[model samples]
Target: MLRGFTPPYTPDGRSSLVPAPPWHYAGTVLSMACPTEPAAAARFLPQGFGRATGRIIAHVCEWQATTDGWELLDPVNAQYREFILLVEAERDGAAVNFCPMIWVDQDISLIRGWLQGWPKKLGQVWMTRSYGLDHPAAAPLRAGTRMGASLAVKDRRLAEAAVTLDGGEGQSLGFLAGPTYGLVGAPSIIGEPTAGALRLVLPGITGRVAGPMASGTAELRFFDAPRDELAALRPTGPAVAAIGNVAITVTGATDMGVVAG
Candidate 1:
C-alpha cells in the first residue's frame, strides 16, 4: 500500500510533495475591493450558481505556514507569497465568493491549492512590508501609511494596487465575508470509457483570524497577459483597501457532489 497522502509515497512519507493537513498559515495581507462589470462577473460562475453580485476582492499576501511538525524541521517550505481574486456570486440564494484565479510563488503551495480546488498558478508576487522601528523607512502602521503590491507571471505584470492607510477601524468588508467556493476536478480522456471525471466543492478553511485592521482608499489595476484572462475581471470603479494580519487553518473538505451538465 502507498504510505503517504500523495505520490512518491515512501516508508517514511518524507518524499511526498505535500504533508497531510491540518495546514496552518499566518500572514499580512493587503486587500482591495471594487465592483466589476456585472456581466463579466457572471461569465466566471459555474453552471447552476445564481446571479453575479458585481464585486471582486483582490489580495496580495506574505505568508508563513506549517503542517503539523513541518515548522521546526522543514522551515523552508513555510514561507511564500500569494495573489488571489475572489469574485462575488450567489449560490442557492445566498452570497459566496468564487475564486477564479490565484497565484503563488511556491511549487508546494501550487499543489496544495490544486488539492483544495483553487486554480492556483505559479507567479511572482510583491508587496510592501512593515517593521516596528522608529526610522522613516519602516513603513509603520499609522495614519498616512502607504502600501503597494503587485503580481506578475513570466516578467509580465498582471495586477497592481496601492493604498493609503487612514488609521480608522476596518470596514465590515461584507462583500468579502461570504464563504469562498472553488471548482476542483479533472477531465476524462477522450477514449477512456471507464475513466471517471471528478469534481467537488473545496474544503472550508477553519480557525480564521483577521487581526486589527487599518482601512484605506485604494487604486487597483489589471493588465492583459498573452495567455491569461485576468483582465476580464478588472474593476471599473475606485477600490476600498485594507491592511491586516491573518491566520487560517485547513482541516478536511466535505464532498459537495459533482456539477451537472
Candidate 2:
C-alpha cells in the first residue's frame, strides 16, 4: 500500500544472502567493543543538545523502482545521493561489526554499492582479522530481540503510512509513517529508521554497540531475503518508529527553485 513499495524483509538465520552486507548474519549480536570516543560524533554535529546533526548516512538499498514496476530513476537517484552524503560524515569505529540482513523493499544492487563504497574496518576479533566475511570474534548472542513478518499493504494510503509507536504521535499530521513507506516488514538486528516509518533501528543492535555513542540502524527491509516485491509485514513486538529516516534540513537547495509560477 505504500506509495511505491509493498512490504519488507530481513535475512534468514542461515546467512544465505551474504558476502556483501553485514558480511555475515549476526543475530542478537552480543559482544561489546566500545569505540575510542563515545562522543566523537559530537564534533560532526556540534551544537547544543537541541541542535540536530545534519550528518547524512550512506546505506545500500535494493528493489524495484516503481508502482507499475516501471522504473523510478529520479527517486532512486535522490536516494543514492543522500547515501553518498552520509558517507561524508566520517564515522570510524574502532570496531564496527558486519551484521548483514535482508529487507524486501530496496534494490539489491544499490545495497551492495552502499556497503562497497562506505568506510569499513578489519580488526582482530579473537585472534584473526575480521575482513571479507571472516571476522574471528564469535560471541554467542547474549541477548537479542527479533520479529518475523508476512503481511502486505492492500491500501495505497496504508502502505506508506507511519504511525508513532509512542512519543512521535499527534505531532505528525496524519498516520503516514514516512514520505514513501508505511513502516512494515522484516525485523532488523539494527534499528535505524528508513523505508518510511516501517524502516528502523533494532534495539538489540544498539544495546550491544560499544562505539562513539553515535546511532544508526540496519534498514532491514532493504536487505531482507528473497529480494522481491509483494513482501508482507512479519511483525516484531513493540518498539520505536524510525523517527529520523530521511533527515531533510534544506538550507541551500532553496536557490535551485526560483519563481516559475
C-alpha TM-score for every candidate: 0.91, 0.20
lDDT of 1 at 59: 80
Among residues 3 or more apart in sequence or in different chains, the pairs in candidate 1 whose N, CA or C atoms overlap within 3 Å are none
lDDT tens per residue, model 2, 1-261: 112111232233222221222221111111111112223333322122122122222222111222222224455422211111120122232212211212223243334322332222111111111122322353111112121112122212111111222222211111111111011223345678433221211111111111111121222221222432211221222212222111211111111111111
The lDDT per prediction is: 0.82, 0.21
Output the lDDT of residue 223, model 1.
98
Please report, as a residue range, the 10-residue window in candidate 2 with the lowest summed lDDT. 25-34
Per-residue C-alpha lDDT of model 1 across residues 1-261, encoded as one tens digit per residue: 558877789998778888888988889877788999999988887767667889988888898889875564766788899998988877778878878889999988898888887889999999999886767888877888888899999989999987888888766353236677777776666687443544656566888888787888888999999988999998899998877788889886666777642
Distance (Å) between predicted and true CA of 104, model 1?
Answer: 0.3
**Candidate 2's error at 85, in angstroms?**
22
Off by over 4 Å in 1: 172-176, 188-200
